[model samples]
Target chain A: MMVVISYDVSTETADGKKRLRKVAKACESHAQRVQNSVFEADLDYSSFMKLKGELLKIMNKDTDSMRFYYLGNHWQRKVEHFGIKKGYNPEGTIIV
Target chain B: MMVVISYDVSTETADGKKRLRKVAKACESHAQRVQNSVFEADLDYSSFMKLKGELLKIMNKDTDSMRFYYLGNHWQRKVEHFGIKKGYNPEGTIIV
Candidate 1:
């Protein structure tokens, strides 16, 4: 199970650039630098937890000016590849 | 079905900024700008084709420094929502 994190940040921090680089460094090889404030990474459960720990340490928690998203697991690609099969009540909740 | 395009550019062009702007304009509302050279868009099949057409017109076919990617459909959210169920031989091709 891998996780992808997307953070929407309002570029208002005095050290936002430094913080962003720190986050990128944590990504190592499981990441693809997508946009300025977005990064795509393939991380397992443990890695996801590790990333969360790292992110929270540098996040600006005093305001809602920043948001974080967690896209969990590689299985998402499968779901994208094949949605719920017909006659399966595709709208029902599914396991990751 | 919407598609997401990721293009990597070498940043060496007389009018790279112009071309990039044109591409961003084509995105309209379904796109999110990420970095200097990356963008993410939720696009349908037809829209993908339209984007392909637009991109090709500005592409420098002579260079190998650029690349494009396509992530298709809104069902992606489902895939991202839930991966293949267990015991389903999840590796087989999916219906998208």
Candidate 2:
């Protein structure tokens, strides 16, 4: 399954800033950053659950917001993109 | 159908800034702003098509990136959110 995770963490204070970095780093470990606060992850059912649990722990329940879009296996057919940044295939080869 | 539209418009130039406001306004006309550049809209097929056309015209293909997610009628079941900002029901009451 492919999951799209988007989050907004409050950066009004030093604590909020630290949480923001922690959340971003956690997502980066499991997925590729498509935008500043968005990530695309290719994971199995168990992995997705684990990732979600980890993120929930890092985010504040009162000030941060997180959304998970379960794109299923046919996510490619479900997404449409336009403009400068092209859509990336999570399964495709990366030269770098 | 319900649509989630997200965009990132380059603001490196004065013209880009203008386009950014245009894009945001276009989206604001049809949906609720859920984030700086994200919107949630409840529209029929024709309305969705018209909104897409209008946004494409406002955006600069060379510098802006837009994504449209078709959540279908069952979007309520397909989305999960966590934290401060509660999800607004697009079809529910809005009392000003």
Candidate 3:
């Protein structure tokens, strides 16, 4: 499954900024950062759940918001790119 | 077709900030703001092209970037909400 994760974390204070970094780091562990606050990853059901849990723990629910778009397995046909391309491939070999 | 438009406009300069607002305004005309820099719209091919052209004119290609995700007609099944739902429905009726 391909999951697209997008988040908005309030950065008004020092703690907020720290939370933002933590949330981004959690997402970066499993996904490719396609935009400033958006990521795309190809993951199994269990891995998706793990990532979701990790992000939930990092983000402040009171001020931060997140959305997950499940592109399923046919994401290649579903995505279109424009402007500066980063050559992001969710299915490509990840050198982790 | 449901198009998810996400953009990253350089906001360091005054002109860049203006361009960011312009780009966002163009997207708001035809879509729902699902996130700070992301929008989702259910538009026909012609309308999508018009919106794309309008955004291209507003954003600077040299420093700004954008991505469009085509979710096809069955977008409802493709999108999932987590943390702070904004009640966005690309298929819902628009007053305008």
Candidate 3 is scored at a TM of 0.82
DockQ of each model against the real complex? 0.03, 0.65, 0.56
lDDT of 1: 0.44
Winning model by lDDT: 3
Show where candidate 3 strays beyond 4 Å. Answer: A85-96, B85-96
Residue-level lDDT of model 1, residues B1-95, one tens digit each, is 43434343333474654555565565545555543333455666676567667766665544312233333343344222111221111121112
* Superposed Cα deviation of residue A72, candidate 1 (Å): 6.8
iRMS of every model, one decimal? 13.0, 1.5, 1.6
TM-score of chain A of 1: 0.57
Q: Name the lDDT value of residue A19 in candidate 1.
A: 60
TM-score of 2: 0.76
Candidate that beats the other on DockQ, 2 or 3, i.e. the better one: 2
Score every model by TM-score: 0.49, 0.76, 0.82
Error of 1 at A75 (Å): 7.3
CAPRI tier for the interface of model 3: medium
Model 2, CA-based lDDT: 0.71
